[model samples]
Target: MLPVFRRRPRYSIGSKLTLIIGAVFGLYLLSVTVIGYVMYSQYRGFSTLASSHFDRAMTAAELTRDAETIAAEVFEMLVSSERSINAGNRRAENLASIYQATRQRLDAVDASDVVDDQTRAELDRWQQPFFSSLERLDTRLAAEQSLQAAHLNRIDELFLLLQQLPPVATTASLPAADQRFVGHALAALSYAAAALSAERPGQIARLHGACQQQLQQLAALSLVSKDFIELRKRLNRTLPSIFTSRRPLLQHGRATLATARQTRVLAQKLTSTTFNYHLQLKAAAQQAITVHQRMIRRSLFGLLLASLALITITVGAVVYIRRAIVLRINRLSAAMHAHQQGHDGPIPCEGHDEISLMGSTFAVFVEARRQAEQQLEQANLHLQQMNAELHRLSEIDELTRIANRRRFDQHMASVWRRALREQSPLGLIMADIDFFKRFNDEYGHQAGDECLYRVAQALAGELHREGDMVARYGGEEFILLLPGLSLAQTEKLARRLLRAVRSLQIPNDQAEGHMVTISLGGASVVPTTHDRIESLVSRADQALYAAKSRGRNRFCSAVADDQNVMVGGTT
Candidate 1:
């Protein structure tokens, strides 16, 4: 409480306007500075996160390609082994040769170092089962071959008897030689068909024809030509289905044993391939590591550069402000002191800030009062003037002259406190015009300002509480802080507000509907629950974003129930 000045003041409107503009611009600049630094930090973090995932994808692709190529080679080798076994005249020698060859191939392939233990184990599992099946087929084929040789010898003995015996007395009286020869030939043919079935007897007819050519000569000596021809035809028909199914069993054994050997070759190839790619990726990762390090270094350098720039700007601002504002204010303080002591002089005015406006206004008032001192002493006129100024300042938007963020903050605090004490819910709604910058550009600056005012007035009328208040909270963003309301109550209010704003239907070609409409987000919470004021406001802000995302001209509410978090009034 200083002594009341007997002098009055006059203010220069130009100086006052300039002061307001400078203060607003400084605040905007500071906010941009802080946001820029935060964004750069986030960008650096995201880049590092993405690089880590790239490394994993590269490793997986390299491993899969190596495994597939090796498995293919093993399949080809097994097919070759099966053909050689089927062609053999000697059973034991042929099987032994196949076993030795398969074992040698397996050993040679297994000896080479390739792939990891886990991959080797995978190859071994299929190999073991296949080898067991092949061993069983080999034993069966050997037994069949032995029976075939015995059947052939029995037929030859019958043929010898047929040749040495006396000729058949007559066709009606069948000789024992004739019967024995027919019986032996049938047994021989049956044995040959059974033996070939083990060798994938699908080709039995061709082999049977080869045998028949030799037997056909014997047909000239035999009286059983008709029976023999019938037997051959019957055997050929039965062989196809049996041989087709058995072919897979014989194929499986040979394939697995052959493929098992191929897996070793494949393992070596995989080891080499894996090692090669590993080297490549390691080199690439190293390069990436270097690049990452450089990026980190670049970020550090950028931070340093930003820090230096900030420091330089801050130093310049401090020096300039001291000369432009602080020193001027100090000079005005001295003039005010002299004026208070009944001496009057023009107050110093050099700055473009609120203090400078006051100085100039005071100097003018002092000059005017000097001209009319007797009248100034007559009434309490200065008190009224001071109150008017205070009221005007309180209502003035600190940033844009349309109700300050401070007013919103203060009203919100009061509304929240009352809502809590009463145990009634408070509703907070926020709205942001979509593509406002584009709108601002399409419409001139003056038009943009007019649009904001129109939107603000629309919202102001919708705030029903005596305790409720509407104010501009951010650039082109408005907040409606409501007291004594439920979420349903808030949403209903929001819907009405949206309709009212849409009714104005200001021309905004950029808007999807080609009409100016606001996207509203509202949050309502019973004040009984303890929560920070910032968090409540944040929730309302999120709801506003939801409304915008769902397309503008909509109202969304942040309401949480046991069922779900809500976007509008209901989930």
Candidate 2:
């Protein structure tokens, strides 16, 4: 049986980052995102609930005011015969306007946003009776006005009949004294007509007594002339109807007044309920605020734990990967350098992790066959090729054709240290494509990649200065470094980059404005001992997140109004 040697699996840089750093960071990010989303949803719910409660309160108040005004109008109509016709019509117009306005406001209010279905149903239950009462009140007022018109017109007709009725006598001739008495009675009726027309209830009541006195005097003529008997009989016939017409007016008045009272009562009840609902929502809002605050504290605790875990995982992964790849590569380089100098030392080919390390060991085996002189030259060539491969892998993003995450990490660290040593500000910008994941889904991965390539080129081209650098940080995110730049300069550059990408007019159906756009978060800082390079990156990240939150296609700074942090916009 032949002995078998199992080849060890060598993990690539990307795979290692994924298994350890990526996994930890992804968990932290997901947790933070979920917590933020929950908080935002809670805030939205609170705000909407508060707004609905306020709107309902205002509407209730308006309804109450309208109901009161309508009731006042009903009261005014009771004295309608006393006021000018235009005045009465104006009141009617006002009542209608208020009622319509209140109804519109009520109709626009949707209580379902804050309250439960059961509460909404209860509100609907209350609304029906209240509005129905208002409608009934409106109807009763119309009936009352009609009855008033009928009553007044009946009095006018009776007065007219009194004036037209001719004297009745056996000789077909009436005495002047009888005629004078009839003329006096007709004059008193004319006065009653004048009072009724003026709508002066007090004058109408006073004229009632005068008109009665005149009728009494005319009654005396019954004994004097046969015409007086017919006039008196005809007058008697109308007096009953004129008196009876008051019954309908009184009935309609009572109905209207009763309905107005009912409307007012219902309106008051509805208003009280609205106030109670507002109070309830206010109390609930307070409770929600407390709950939100607790959640914020709890989320903060969770974040701290996640951050610690992320740091631990990151440090461990960095140590292991650096030791595995970098240590072996360094040792191989030393070996090659030693062989070239004709100084042969111990070249320990210990690890299975590095294929390059394995290849170096194989080259040593052929040293005797090819002769050490020739092998040294070949080893130098191979080492140079290996270094070039490692540099390429370390710096370039495979997909975006730009500087990768490794370059960003290395560059940011270097710049931060340089800033710390020189005491100059370092500007960092973190940018994200708005709705990029949706864009990717709509356009397909091929188009998305092409879009990224184009966007990266545009972004890279924007950095004309030698001190400026652009790198593909991650999915749909890019980072730029501008060393020795102030916040204003960084903000200006960020907006310029934003415009540059947006100017491409890359068709992104999923994004707002129906085109591809980028949101940038910018931060410039003079390094301090207390903070790490990640602090500046975190600032930029937060600003980027803020830009996205504000509807995207803009720029934001970590410090909202701090003199050291300037924000810009567009695109």
Candidate 3:
């Protein structure tokens, strides 16, 4: 069965090439059209976001500065017997402006442009300071993290202690009352342990309720556990200690838990406001850019397939066309190869035919790809800088502008361990303002905050040593860690700390000195494997108590003996 296959009549080479060049140019135009459409859509979003973000951010900046000026003017009005009426009027005007700007930013800004992160430079400036509010939240988070660690450790210890005793008598083996109490107490301990990680406001309320329940269970268990211990002293040896460790949490844990809840709430509010603002802007930009990139890639890939097929077909067609036409085809191939090698070598664009148009289209594609890559790189860099700024803000204290408690703890621990290894003496001074509570009661919290700032600065100024650090321990209390300082050096430093506060000479009628002053207790010791931190802290506290007892505004030192414990007295 032999079949004769007849070949279809071949078109002229010019006809074949006309079709190829026309089709490729048509694809080029389609790509250009689609790209224009995508660009317009993305540009609207990007530009609106940029402009809106810029305006609001600038407005916020201006308002903050204006507000500060207004505050200063009010202070001047208060302190000066003869204040400038013009300054007062200017203050009023700035206040009004700030109020209006804040209102506009919060409520009246255009809905579509509500969240824009267009200007990186402005965001860089604004976001860093805006995130300063989160410094307070960071302190709270560190406290919560510490609480969580403590809770976990106690729970683990409670379990280990529980393992030392026999399990509860089975329900069948014991009286109903005994069994109920034992089961409920165990369940409550578990609940209390689980509550440590609950962060939501609702979760905190539920946890409080659970804590109440746990207390009830503990009360019920107390009677039974006591009776059991009375009956079987040796077998229930660890139960008393376990209950001691576990029961106080139900009673005294509310403050810590409430603080944690507040921390979580504040952190959520602050981070969602600032961090998420940038985060969403970055996301939107990336998404639009990613879509644009995908479209470009798809176009480039389609063009690649078309070019390959066209070249193959046109090469064959050129064989029939002419040698001169064949030379143009070779030039086109060279251009393709150069593009592949990341070169935009000269393309032979001598004619106004389809091949010349193809060369132009391919050049545009290469240029667009390069531009897209550069844009993506810039976006990535912006995101990284914001992240770094956030991290830096978290470690700083926004108010007192000193090392916060968390920083102090970290620095102290690091220095302590290093000093321990080097066998160097480390000194810790715990100091507090005399009659600060009374000062707050009389002058108010704002005044107290100002006083704290003043005292912290004065204390910081005294510590010129490289390894010395002063930190705001809490309200009205500051701690200083001086590495490689002996008892004498520490006492000298402690005295100097007291003098610094006295130098402030801020009027405080409640204090014995008739001005703001501090009482300091210092402890210095060489680290030992056998020693505990509590021992050193206890000595310092005893000295502090002695200082408070003797009188206010004095320095006291705790001397260590062979027992590796502090003996408290005035130095």
Number of the top candidate by lDDT? 2
Question: How many Å off is the CA of 327 in candidate 1?
Answer: 62
Model 1 segments beyond 4 Å from truth?
A: 1-380, 398-402, 561-571
What RMSD, rounded to one decimal, does every model reach? 43.3, 45.7, 67.9
Local accuracy of candidate 2 as per-residue lDDT tens digits, 23-86 = 7678778778867886786677667545765565566556556655655664565545433222
Off by over 4 Å in 3: 1-389, 562-571
Q: RMSD, model 1, all Cα superposed?
A: 43.3
lDDT of 3: 0.62
Q: For candidate 1, lDDT tens digit of each residue in 397-446?
A: 64445567877777777877887787888888888876788888999888
Off by over 4 Å in 2: 1-379, 560-567
- Model 3, range 228-303, lDDT digits (tens) per residue? 4443342234333333443343333444334334433433443334344445445655665576667667766766
Task: Give Cα-based local distance difference scores for all models.
Answer: 0.60, 0.70, 0.62
Give, for candidate 3, the lowest lDDT window spanning 10 residues: 562-571
Enumerate clash totals for all models, in the order shown.
3, 3, 1
The clash tally of candidate 1 reads 3
Looking at model 2, report the run of 10 residues with the lowest lDDT sum.
Answer: 81-90
Q: Score candidate 2 by TM-score against the native.
A: 0.34
Candidate 2's clash total is 3
